[model samples]
Target: MKILVVDDDPGIRELVRITLQDAGYAVAAAAEAIGALSMLEAENPDLAIVDVMMPGMDGFALTRELKSFKDMPVLLLTAKGALEDKERGFRAGSDDYVVKPFEPKELLFRVEAILRRYGKEEEAPILAGPLEIDRQSYEVTCGSRTLLLPLKEFELLTILASRPNVVFERERLLELVWGLDYEGDGGTLSVHIKRIRGRLEGLTDRVSIVTVRGVGYKMEILP
Candidate 1:
């Protein structure tokens, strides 16, 4: 998971970044909301950790804007731990709230909870744009339509859709889906991708399986 941390305090920003990174999450830090907004345009981080106090816009306002316009989850991190502060955080559209003087383990737990609730937990339904891959039911849907795909194709799509815009190297995907014990040529992967692409054609306008020549592939969801 990728988390963007927004805080005016350099110490706090570094602290959060290191904490999340140590917990095996990709992280980016922004000093304010505007910088966070710019990062959102460049890459779609899974969630954002926002500070409640900043120079131009407070975290409440930023959370409201992100929830209203961007439809993204925000976790408010601040020193305000009163009951009313949490209420305000909820009203501002924060999915989770954390106080500054918090245990790192507790923060990780809360983050996991929010991610699980949103179907982003490990092995949950992989959602990206208009596509959803339900691992439980082994079903794939794009837009309003459900697609029937071969086992290999479905697995391939699941891997890509689970982490949208994250480039997966060919070897890495092969290891994950086909297993390290399974011996297969690169053509096997190519064929599977082609089949998946064929099934996805015209099914959704937002999803695109992009090939990064000589490297790997990534699923891009265009707005």
Candidate 2:
């Protein structure tokens, strides 16, 4: 597997490189967001491990941008263990999150686990007109241009894409994507959907999340 490791800290970058290389995987390293984006254009790596905090772009932004091109599994490494941080990671479209001061073995295991569970063979990209989704890599492509989508937006897209014309009540989206056991601000769901639509703007004539006339919401695919 070819992996891209992006982090501002040289020590962390080296640690990831050495560990993955020892495990027999091709790895690429980038210290900043611009470098990472450039490397992505050239390498087309199988997976990416991103650090949440950085000088400017940050891991969240990177994950969202990368989602436009490839569904490559991303494992976010961050010291912030707060729920908001984790939620932010998920919202940015990361496959998994790992807190800092973690064992290398643990990180490797989590990466392997995600790859195994949602392996390459199952990741056929989904295309709905201008929007494209790579199930395997979790990348979204719109025409030749790709849009960066936060993790929740990606999940919400996947759910909606699965049914196309099917209407999923707002509560259903909350339960399925956010998790039935998850407890957060209830308004967060609408905000997320709205953001997703904004990213997908101009791709279609109507809203993806259609109001069900006082019922809930449904994904409206262009015919």
Candidate 3:
């Protein structure tokens, strides 16, 4: 796999290059956003790892630019750990965020997770021809409005929207939506369902999510 590593710090750039190269990935190193853009044009990489702080056109801005083309996976490697910074990264189109002073193993794991998420990502259904999902971008388009979802919400919507008219049991939803190791009860899934339903309130009468009596929930295809 090919990866573009962008960081202004030469030492950091070399370190990342060596580490990723050793792991059997073709690595392209860039010191600035312009250089990174040039490299992207020259060699369309599978993924990009960018540092948040740079002299000009920081990683956030670069990520915004990258998303304009298509749904490209971008991972942020930065020292900024505040929730705001993390949110900003996501808002800027980052697929994953890793805080600085991180373990190499942790970085490796995050990268793998992001790649896997993109690989297995499912496209959202046309939902009676109103809702559209671009799995790679995690974007839900309703009419002319396009909404960007948080990671968990995105995953949840993907699962339900992928299989319309099918009743997914509560246990199944918990395991799939909340993860296998999640300790929360069925209520957790309900919260997410409520949130999704709230967002689709206007369409609830048409493209609704139905509670399957004693079972769980199914995204009902309106007649």
Q: Tell me, by lDDT, which candidate is best.
A: 1
Q: Over the full model, what C-alpha lDDT does candidate 2 score relative to the true structure? A: 0.77
lDDT, candidate 2, 1-223, per-residue tens: 6889999999999978866754446899999878999987789888889999999999999999888767768899989999999999999899999998776667766877877866642335666655678755678876576665777788778767665676667766675566546688658987887787777675555436676765666677665
TM-score of 2: 0.53
TM-score of 1: 0.54
Q: Could you tell me the lDDT of residue 1 within candidate 3?
A: 74
Q: Write the residue-wise lDDT of candidate 3 on 1-223 in tens digits.
A: 7888999989878767755653346788899999888877778887889999999899999999777755778999998899999999999999999887655545655776887887832233434347786756777777787778777776667666766777777876665545446787777778888888888775445667789988988776666
- Residue 39, candidate 3: Cα error in Å is 1.3
> Given candidate 2, what's the lDDT at residue 48?
89
Q: Locate the minimum summed-lDDT window of 10 residues in model 3.
A: 120-129
Ranking by lDDT: 1, 2, 3
1 or 3, greater by lDDT? 1
Local distance difference test values of all predictions, in order? 0.81, 0.77, 0.76
Off by over 4 Å in 2: 121-223
Which parts of model 3 have CA positions greater than 4 angstroms off?
A: 120-223
Rank order (by TM-score, best first): 1, 2, 3
